[model samples]
Target: MTQKTNIQSYITIQNNEIVLNGTSVFKIEPTDFADFSKQAYRNFDVQYPKFFKMDALSKLAFLGAELLLSPITSGEQENNIALVLANKSSSLDTDVKYQESISDQENYFPSPAVFVYTLPNICLGEISIRHQLKSENSFFIFDAFNTEFMSNYSNILLNSNKADVVLCGWVEFFNDDYKAFLCTISKEESTKYTNETINTLYNQ
Candidate 1:
């Protein structure tokens, strides 16, 4: 039987604000990580542990997953969740900083701290760790987001029954501009995954 999948929930972050499941969760103008951290914990029930601190990418992915999972996921279903993401700038900020450190001959010491974030897939790893999800994972990049590509890829994974649930989106961070959109997909029908529904969501 071909596994079916439907849109479960979605979150979008732009203009230094977060919108979850089509509702604005928090909006911060010119806010930093600390500001977001506080708001996320307060409004979303996120408890930041003292140890195993997370970085910016991890935090963003975590929040995105949390929002998507809250309304749709149950105990066992969470374990079956998978993550697939795509972005245009694949950790370019870290790549640039790493190259800058090596540019000068005298002070050319490459920092591992900056090196680890150079890969685009680290965000997926961070999210998996946060949620303890051990399922299929993939990361891809293109010059720009192709909705057709994303929809086809996601449909293939779900239709093949490779994953019981999938978390997918486009997360692009360039310079000071950051935009993220995530949606959860499962084998159910509702108002979220239809062609017209997705188009409306993107158009909004």
Candidate 2:
């Protein structure tokens, strides 16, 4: 029998609201993506000060990863879980900002910190460092939320014995719009994540 994977828990953040398993757990007052993300981090009481320095894309990815991995977070899970995140805008959100920073010929001040997050995969690195995870990590950019790809690739990592758990979902931020939906997948028996389920959750 082929090993089965299950969706342990899922978190979705968008439209100034953060929902877990279809319930609105937290929501910020109406504001732009920047301030809304900042408020979300504050509400989570994230102690990491580096969060303040992160660009909008990284901040959103970091917070979503933290929330999805909160339950079983520990030193033991290190090197066991794979991070597979996807998005439509491949860090262009920060790319534009970085471009603007250097666009000012008179006040040109390129920030290394901001420039570091220019790649969408950097968020995976950030989460890996935060949790000490030394497992397989990859980021893919598509036209939109591709549920088939998310499910297919995650299962490959698990079935291939490369990782015990997989963190799969989308973290997208462009201009004033942003949304993050992350789900943890494991071999343990729980709610199974089918392609339909993924689409439903994302569209919710």
Please name the candidate that would achieve the greatest lDDT relative to the true structure.
2
TM-score of each model, paired residue for residue = 0.84, 0.92
Q: lDDT tens string, model 1, 1-204? A: 765567877888777688877789888677765566457666776654621254455556667777776565554545777798888888886678678988999888888877877788988987776667888998888887666777677888888877778888887776646677888877778666565444356556
Which TM-score value belongs to model 2?
0.92
In model 2, where do residues sit more than 4 Å from their true spots? 76-79, 191-196
**lDDT score, candidate 1:** 0.73
What is the TM-score of candidate 1? 0.84
Residue pairs in candidate 2 whose N, alpha carbon or C atoms collide under 3 angstroms: none
User: Candidate 1, 86: how far from true, in Å?
Assistant: 0.6
lDDT of 2 by residue, 119-163 (tens): 999899888887788999999999999998898889889988888
Pairs of residues at least 3 apart in sequence or in different chains that clash in candidate 1: none
